[model samples]
Target chain A: MTKPAYEGKQPSFFTTNAEFIVRSIRHSLRNVETMIMAIVLPVMLMLLFTYVFGGAIDTSGNYVNYVVPGIILLCAGFGSSSTAVDVASDMKNGIIDRFRTLPIHSWCLMTGHVTASLLRNLLATGIVILAALLVGFTPHADVWEWLAALGIISLFILAITWLYAAIGLVAGSPAAASGYGFALLFLPYLSSAFVATDTMPSWLQGVAEHQPITPVIETIRSLLLGGAADEHAWFAIGWCLLILIGAVIWCTWLYNRRAGRR
Target chain B: MGLAIEVKGLYKRYGSHEVLKGMDLSVAEGGVFALLGPNGAGKTTFIHILAGLLRADRGIVRVAGYDVTMEKLRVKMSISLTGQFAAVDDMLTGTENLRMLGRLNGLSAAQAAARATELISQFDLEAAGGKRVGTYSGGMRRRLDLASSLIVPRPIVFLDEPTTGLDTRSRRSLWDSIQALASQGITVILTTQYLEEADQLADRIAVIHEGRIVASGTPAELKARIGEEVIELLNEEGEVSHTLTTDGTITSIQDQLLMLAQQAPPNARVRLRSPSMDDVFLALTESADSNSNKEAKRA
Candidate 1:
């Protein structure tokens, strides 16, 4: 009853993932609001912090240089939330079930989602960087510093996107996923991403110095503006890697457990 | 010549609720097998097990000669599942969705485009294919969803409540597509709550009640199980009981029924009609309900 042509031609694992990646990328491209949110949120934040709050804050050098790095990391956070919403929708909409019934591996689909998010984050970061340059934000990064900053930002996006992907799986709806994701967008405000830590209350300064986003923001700011980045650079990479590894493990474990039970 | 799907000793439960208890089914290739059940009768559960979507607590399910659990990949390769909901991507256009599935299922670039074009015309989605599915009508979405599942020439297809929530006209259109598939020798297993749909489309029908098949045979054979003549009695509150009798000819039966209606309560009505798939379904499930109720009283 089967055709000989379609037989024995199971799509290779990598090919399957590549196809899913293409599908996810297509969906992301069509979601105009999420695309806008990805670029606009950070750009809006850049303009607001550069103009509205630039007068009140004090940085040793140009405020754009101080704020651009922070806004880029903030952009990554906002963009990862879109990953959460996408995952939640796929789960609730029966598309995941269709994927499950197919011969394709579940990890391939998850990887596809993460890959699309990485591209979105990359494009969003590029837009912010270009916008920052337009506003006279100069990056003094040498070769190593440039490589290190780009590596750190990519890792940061990968780490946060994986974490939100897990959150999306557990979320009941896309709205709930986005609601939980809203917390990620707000994490920057509590860190040195916006105002100087010293200007904050002494207690808040302690939190601002110790939180995860602070180190990454400080490291990028140092790299972009030509300063010593020894401790901050390692700490930022460590945090991003730590989150990425931990999240990948957790999401894989959750997927296996759910697949087993479901 | 061989069975497209074969199942035995299927059992599933959600805590205390047993959905499919030691149930079994076999479906030959190249025909529509309609599973009819009232809500919670485990029709969906059975299809899920066959499609390798839900794990059965105990069963040996073989689809296209592949064990549903042990050789799930093989089973999946030979089958396509269109779930109760339209599972196609809302963000993609109808053509894009079909092309995406074709590529995901391992067709080459040109093959995918050709297949997508073929399905677009076959499903009559030429105009709707360009529009985002988020803006599609329910009928258009369902047609596209069905088309997406047929990216390859799978020997078997599982359609779970495929016509659910659609208007009559849309449902008829979907029915025609199912008929078209069967005509191409594609085996179809469809779970439906509509008896008329079963009667109209199924070569064979199974009535499921309380997680087990209460009756199975050709649609006419199933109706014949409840006898040819059905006497429907409606009381004042509009509660109806359909009973089959082997009493004399149709006219004689109607004569006796009219006399019985005389002693009945006010506004009572009695009608004599041929047994339909609905009658067979109701008869089997009603009997199952009463038998369980009796056991409950005894316990």
Candidate 2:
């Protein structure tokens, strides 16, 4: 009997999935000049916040320490929209339709895209971190705690990146993806990132306190600062999980529907 | 073994408009079947339904003896489709695209690489294989697209207007590739508006018009149906001469032509013939349109 093509060549789950991810990362990283500009944006923001506006914010401890993690998160959030733009551009350019005819798993395309975005976000995050450290801001968390914080934040970023990707898939064009991203950026600011939710009006404060970003930021802050654990961590994880599941299901349905039409 | 592809009473609708109304077709294994139709004739819909990309409203569709709906994966594995535009990633090189597809089709890494190289050489794309697809000319991109489809040697292939935008040389190259595949016993179902494409490549041709199969036969059979000679007479009086010349008077003309041929033994002989495929196409569409118009008026 003739052996099948996959015989003796079965890839491990990680390797199979990682191959696409690596391809996407390589494609994204090829444009190093643009990424350098993206890296600079966060570093410049960190400097402006630390030097110019640090005195105005009434944080008792170092302002850089208080804002560095938030800036890193912001950088991740801001830069993630490019992933959506890339997806939308691909859709517009007939690449998605080409991918549909291939034998790859449907989710592989999105996985590759999200992985690339995460890699770029990590690079941008590193630049911000270096800039913060250069200005004497040190992470208070232990190594494990910092790792844990990083893990949670990465998960959150991945979840939201998928959501943005779905938006991009549905958006009319790449410009629309950027427009949607601009709308999403306001959510983090409304949360507990730049200001306390208590400072807002009661109605706005209620929304900010209960929204998904608030718990996520709170959880990360607690982990990084060695503060008391809050119930918001569970809520944040639940929200991320829900969003991840819902986005995947909805996007897959749309993709299948569109594929069927073609 | 009943048929390579079988469709029975396939129907599809979009919104309030019905695109396919009970279309049916079957193709024997290892045959080059050409589907000829004008635009909006629902040929693409039929192909999509058979490919398992579209679900028919009501029908039975099977590819390579597997039900398209229940055995979608099997059906998919048995066939490959190439549409009008080349479906390839512009960022990736030609070799990379083929290798990626090979891996997706379950080839080992080494196997994928070897298969990619083989396809590159086969398609005469070796010189351009290392360059990104974005830099490839139209013909090179089309060849790469065709190469990508052959990544996993499928038994049946669906090509929808594959040579629409190609230059003559590129079109001829594709025709050669298609013939090579078919000669290897791969069943091919192709749709083309270019009549010559159908005439040259298709062993059998089916012309579809207004969601219906207007005519089907071997190219010789279809051309034979058109008879041997077409005489074009110039009418000096325009519409009046045309109306008078074709006014249900063919019986008399037929008799006269027979009598004249018998009486005159000349070096040159004139024989009357039926219309060509282009003529048949024009007549069918024109009649279908007028019939629908009359029905609308009556309604």
Highest DockQ: which candidate? 1
lDDT of 2 by residue, B50-133 (tens): 876678898888899999889766776788888776878777889988887777666878988988898899999989999988
In candidate 2, stretches whose alpha carbon ends up further than 4 angstroms from where it belongs are A1-16, A31-38, A58-61, A89-104, B234-276, B291-299
DockQ value of candidate 2: 0.32
Worst 10-residue stretch by lDDT in candidate 1 chain B? Answer: B239-248
Task: List native contact recovery per candidate, as a fraction of 1.
Answer: 0.49, 0.21
**A1-262: candidate 2 lDDT, tens digit per residue:** 0124523232445555776786677678765665776678778877887878877874564787767766777787777777778777766764554455444554577788888888788778777777888997876788888887877778787878888888877777889877987788778777877667888999999999988888888887888777864687788889889887887787777656654543
Worst 10 residues of 2 chain A by lDDT: A1-10
Per-residue error for A169 in candidate 1, Å, reads 0.6
TM-score for chain B considered on its own, for each of the candidates: 0.90, 0.85
lDDT at position A80, candidate 1: 85
Best by TM-score: 1
> Candidate 1's residue-wise lDDT over A198-244, tens digit each?
98999989988988898999988888788787898788888888999
Residue pairs in clash, model 1: none
RMSD of 1: 3.2
DockQ metric for all predictions: 0.46, 0.32
